[model samples]
Target: MAYATLEALIKQYGLDAVLLVADRDQDGDIDADVVEDALTAATSEIDSYVGVKHRLPLPQVPDVLVRVCGDIALYRMSSEGGQLTEDKRQRYEDAVDYLKRVAAGTASLGLATPPEQETSGDAWFEAQPVRFGRLL
Candidate 1:
């Protein structure tokens, strides 16, 4: 994943930071040092983001929670086919549930509002018509 893209996403969403976690699956061995290096590079490129390596116990993996401006956008990045698993999906749902519980009270991260759409410089040009005739 490109760190620049991640940074742009954060900025567009007005998020404080994003949490990244990774794990290896059964029969899949990866070099910890190499992974660490990649993670370091990603963090260096993106500000306020933290990466952590976790070892999941049998039948379960760690849930990832990203606290952005008090609202959490949770995600699960699975090593298996690099797809999100049901457990992680559930975790994300649970996070939303928790958010509703404490929405009325104050929190350390603060309440997060809905993310705003990012504007592009050439957005209008893309939708406008172009002159095809030659202009002397």
Candidate 2:
């Protein structure tokens, strides 16, 4: 993802505000320690700290997914700026569609699997070796 491009789009489209939904156990508070950890963990040059307008704490993974989907919908529907042009409109639509699928998947997983166990962050890191090949 191009952070500079995304930032430009946000400014051009007046999408200055964003609502970030994350699991309460992970990102409830914007503490310096948390920020530093995220910075250390980030694999891309794009700043991880950006795009957070308001942090909505969620107790469960399903709840977090639902809230994020809702937030994306709300942002797309907001009338604070002019109607989005074709390219921007398509981008927003694509993002919302992807998020919807993610939310559905998360909900299904939450239902099928025990809630007491969540995938570890290491699982994500381990997959990256085979998934992304190498970081640019």
Candidate 3:
């Protein structure tokens, strides 16, 4: 599953705003279809880099991922814009780092495995919680 969708992006940023940034022409013209294609590319790139297969849908999507997708599309549409500020670049880099961390967190969660495999036999007993008081 894609981490982000065009509709969600549109909802996050108003249609006019998203179009202005994402549209290459920037003529106050917006094409949902073209914008969607850019979103698809961004999603694919994110998934590929994060080492997450696009087939499994994440239970919860992160807002940062959505923001990254929008940023990526806007950057591409800006005609090799040399005017991007250092802060924007820093934020983009930070977003990518956060994405990697999220992917790592999911990997640790082991969500891809079956429910039964979440805990098996001695695995649960290996690290039992400490108990201070006995029940009556």
Candidate 4:
């Protein structure tokens, strides 16, 4: 589920801007599904890349993520116009890089709850290669 709403996107990015980017058909009104698809794609990409597994937008999302989601939304929208500007591409790249550090345990998620570890005990032993010399 996406943490940010369309209203938030509109408010943060400007309704006219968002509508302009999202209204593919130039029908004047922003397509709700287009907005949703971009949001979903952004969330999925970020969550997966950050090792958040499969969930997105997170329940109590962090501020960085919120902004990243917005950036990703805009990035995805830019696909329609062809050729993403370096600055725009860098915006999402920076956010993804930060998340990469978080996923690597080098950085933090700030106030949001961190992604839970799902490792079981004795993973090394469990992964030991089978011996072929002697049989019981």
Model 1 agreement with the true structure over 63-89: per-residue lDDT tens digits? 222232112221422332254556556
1-136: candidate 4 lDDT, tens digit per residue: 7746788788777987787778877789888898899898888877876655323445568777778888887788877646367877888788788878777767776644333443553333235687676776
Expressed as tens digits, the lDDT of each residue in 1-136 for candidate 2 is 2112222323333333321211113343323332233223321211121212111222233433333333333234332233335654565465455444534443232334323234543432223346555678
Runs of candidate 1 with Cα error greater than 4 angstroms are 1-74, 79-81, 106-136
Q: How high is the CA lDDT of each candidate model?
A: 0.32, 0.32, 0.59, 0.73
Off by more than 4 A, model 4: 52-59, 111-136
Tens-digit per-residue lDDT, 11-69, candidate 3 = 86578656665555556666666676767777776776554532334466566667877
Better of 1 and 2 by TM-score: 2
* Candidate 4 local Cα displacement, residue 95, angstroms: 1.5
Worst 10 residues of 2 by lDDT: 45-54
lDDT of prediction 2 = 0.32
CA displacement after TM-score superposition, residue 19 of candidate 2 (Å): 18
Candidates sorted by TM-score, descending order? 4, 3, 2, 1
